[model samples]
Target: MNDRKPNLRSVRELTPALEFCTIHGYRRAYRVAGSGPALLLIHGIGDNSTTWSTVQSQLAQRFTVVAPDLLGHGQSDKPRADYSVAAYANGMRDLLGVLDIEKVTVVGHSLGGGVAMQFAYQFPQLVDRLILIGAGGVTKDVNIALRVASLPMGGEALSLLRLPLVLPSVQAIGAVAGKLLGTTALGRDLPNALRILRDLPEPTATSAFTRTLRAVVDWRGQVVTMLDRCYLTESVPVQLIWGERDAVIPVSHARMAHAAMPGSQLEIFERSGHFPFHDDPDRFVEVVQRFIDSTEPAEYDQTALRQLLRTGVRERAISGTVDTKVAVLDAMGTDERSAT
Candidate 1:
């Protein structure tokens, strides 16, 4: 007998694997791959667990990787209600509960980062460590256009009625905009930005882009404040991964987060952009693995773990076998520019 690889269909196919255990009310689709201690991965807006494919593959060798699609995004059900960060966090908590995972290191990106912060704050006992990659919840001032686009009327503004043949116009404008925009303004390197946009899944009526925008705009300050309080109370070890060229949520936010959570570690990816994982998976995995190794529970079987985490546990954090240099921002600095 042979076991065929699971068919990679639409995002919805991921649900059956993840819903292996009962999560009451919310049907969150998830998948558990590799073997070892559990590591829960939550993705940001407009992305699914597939985004973590590379990192998950590497980490799975060391731990049982549980990656879930947030309610509205991947294969999970999208309800017809305003999505709040708190709700998303709660959903994750329930997902873990049903999956029989009492405690695990939680990793989140962009919007998912905010969700992870909320979860760690709300259920500190359940979270061993927190890893945030370009997470949100710092400020309201996002991209000026995104800010405008998120408004109630903004969605209408994007329709072809406002600008006939808008999609074509957007493509043309994006081309010229790329030329005019600097690295600091484009959010990512021109090539990377183009790649990200080009690679975005083809839009369907149910794409959830607008819904994600609403969540991004609405889910703000309150969650961060709660996370700050969590840091003060629990002080769970935090690992922050940031891209130097990320303009969507500036690296300045990481500085603020480090100050707010004194115990947190910050790693800035130089010459990298918004989606650092896409640009440099090895470095991302290195830093995350270090944080996990630093905080792994003693109860877990070490010898078994060695088999799980393929690479040596003591390998360099940001660099693997070869040296990879990076410019880091000192959290303790008063001058933010000098720090970054």
Candidate 2:
């Protein structure tokens, strides 16, 4: 029941109509348009909700689209806080509560996909449908460049990229180097380093990015995996989308995740890369529309959740206690000594 009005604009508009909300002392900014069942769009690391620019309006025709700039990125306030997936999930829940929107069809890209999965895990009742695009939480095999950036020494190196004073000079040099090298991987090591450099010039954004990246990634590729817990979403409708030409996180992850969850749907964009939604916005929107139209929203059981929690207790009872194990060992020792 927040009386404050939300700032909104259509995709057809030139200047963006961004909205702001103060949630628990943090200034959270988001954009909302159209109306129907609520839809939450989450952006990836180092990127904001602007990444959803291509498809947001088109989808808004049928659904109420709520795309927020995650805390520590874009217009949102960046504070020294826990940047873990669980923390983000809780934040999303709180944001929705503040807006008074109960249920949503959650759509996330890359790092946002990890957050979306964690949200569903933490608050299954709030999630109606789940969609992941080029998600990072399904596999261990991430690009080596990202893994390297997760190291302790990587922070010092990354700081140079955030020097706003020197960015113009760097861009000038980069432009000169680019013409000679063309669009090559070495020209821009990560999938979107050049874009990140341009978009996220603030020191706070850089710091948040570094902290966020290290939490889920390490020198050994991605440290977080949703493969083990994907079964929990069995009752909920899940969709996996990936670019066939994706070099950042590889389409293999989508395949693996799709295989792990037999009930989920998989769509591969043949001519797309890391950002498939951008590669073919119309097709992406069409696919999402079709999926939403075809599937029914999830109806989770509260009793099943309690049952799932109680399983460990039953398992422990079957396995016996620490005292029982010690007692058995003592009895074996007694029998052996007596026989000897």
Candidate 3:
């Protein structure tokens, strides 16, 4: 057995500060830092506030960085109830109400991105600006790898036995076997899960794990419905940041977002994966700062700014579609035409 420690560069930068809030009939934990316009930081699936440590630290100089460990992940509670984007958004709503922060700039990544979009839709008055990083709300295009992970038999091998309903003896055996060989294989498809378990604060690991899994399967339906239409009623200064190499939620989703919200500004980073902040923290910081700095740009020049929206609409207009199978596999019914 390889007993060497996992190479974790992400958690090293995290400065965790705890806060308690109730969500889904359970007390949840979150981390808060800095002070300015309330900036609620949301994380992707299988990750916690720690994933935003690098980006949050940079933004803290200009905004209050509020990164929460979503319900059932990180230090939060993990109940047996099904989870969904609406649940996560409601969890956020409860958190914000408890904090007494009326309006905020919500930044969500991956699953958190989907949650952020819903939050904006449900509580438009509470959100001042929106930033979605490789977000998954607007498009039904999900990674094949993640879809595979959702299957009963295809999940992490240890998860097969560690189920909340499983026998203790079987779970124990699976835990031992999992510690030996299961995690490595699971990490190949679910990178963030491996990262979450390794970086989990304490006893919260097991529950958070279960909750995250439940959230994934439950959130798909409602989120897909929300994405079919443009949710924001008023212009709220939307910004999108996508990784060119994102395998989890392809950058194609950004294109969909641009099409849906024609006013949003999109930034695509080549060579970055699911978590572009990990790939290039400095560049991420720069892009976000630029967006915030130029927020007050001339209102009359909206057309020029709209033209600069980088969610790949112009590119899509040219290329049309990458692969028809992507649409069929995602089950996102839409007009399909082959690229010339």
Candidate 4:
């Protein structure tokens, strides 16, 4: 595996130029390349489309890759309308519709992963395959930092990032920490995390980040989960990728999601952190290409989906599962204590 970290400058140079479109009267920025099947890439919270810069070119060679900056992140307009996962899904749909693209293999990372799942749930007709990398919305377990940031004062706290010297101090600390814990997940992901922090200094970006984070996370952990609807993905090709040492979202969520979603594939990167694609772009690209080549694009069947929803998930399909039960209960405004 190539352990070389991505050079942002070079990656940006190789990626397609940013394109703009108006969705719901807000300007949305995205990049597109190649011309085969479509691939829609969504970046996580506090991240832009540039997160996929390393693999975008390679993926674009074989597929029409489209990477968009969510409304609250990157170059997109950070309107205070809505930052919910479902809202982001709607934004993606509108963006794709404007691009004249009918369907795509949706790839999402971290918070983007939650949006991707929401996309699949809200607009099943648009997704050909689902690829989630260290995705959120798996379980309540998340990095404590996120949990804390989701608190009410989190937005106010972010204002401190904009104070003089604070950003530089954080960067310096991250540099030192990177060298000290070079082999750990935090060390490996510090650069990307720093990049995200730099974006937070901006008030609009900070507000967007806070709202987005609070939508799927809280003082406890992640507030949203996809396990209850994992069974509904039975007709779509699903792939879960995670870093074994991911400090943001635990890799155990991958196993639980894999169990809940029948026939889904999971790939764990041994030496990676939160950004598996960045940690090993070569393998990430290979894995994605191989998965696409091996599996058939999902054919949306309204009848089948209706029947499945009406009949509900089979007991055998999700039997012997604790995660599903917890998710079901959580969805119904209850906790594990009441569930048990």
Best by lDDT: 4
Off by over 4 Å in 1: 1-26, 157-212, 215-230, 296-340
Q: Distance from true position, residue 104, model 1, in Å?
A: 1.2
TM-score of 4: 0.91
On TM-score, the candidate that comes out on top is 4
Q: Candidate 4, which segments miss by more than 4 Å at Cα?
A: 1-14, 319-340
Clashing pairs in 4: none
TM-score of each: 0.70, 0.81, 0.70, 0.91
* Candidate 3 runs further than 4 Å off: 1-16, 22-25, 154-193, 197-226, 231-234, 296-340
* lDDT for each residue of candidate 3 in 39-137, tens digit (9 for 90 to 100): 898987768788886777677666677899887677777665546777778888989988989888888998888788888766666877888998875
Candidates 1 and 2: which is better by TM-score? Answer: 2
Ranking by lDDT: 4, 2, 3, 1
Q: What are the C-alpha RMSDs, in order, of all predicted structures?
A: 10.2, 11.1, 10.3, 5.8
C-alpha positional error of residue 107 in candidate 3 after TM-score superposition, expressed in Å: 0.5
Residues 58-164 of candidate 2: C-alpha lDDT, one tens digit per residue: 88877888999998888899998878877888989999998899999999899999899999989999999999999977656787878888899876776786555
Model 3 has an lDDT value of 0.64
lDDT of each: 0.62, 0.77, 0.64, 0.86
Task: Summarize candidate 1's per-residue lDDT along 1-340 as a digit string, tens digits.
Answer: 6575543323332222444333555456777776567788988766777778767767776677899877766666666644667777788888887777888888888888888877775666687788888887754435555566566775455443234455455567777777677555373545443433442333331335566676556322121322223233224678888888787778866766655554578899987777788779999888888887786542433454344335421212222112111222122221211100
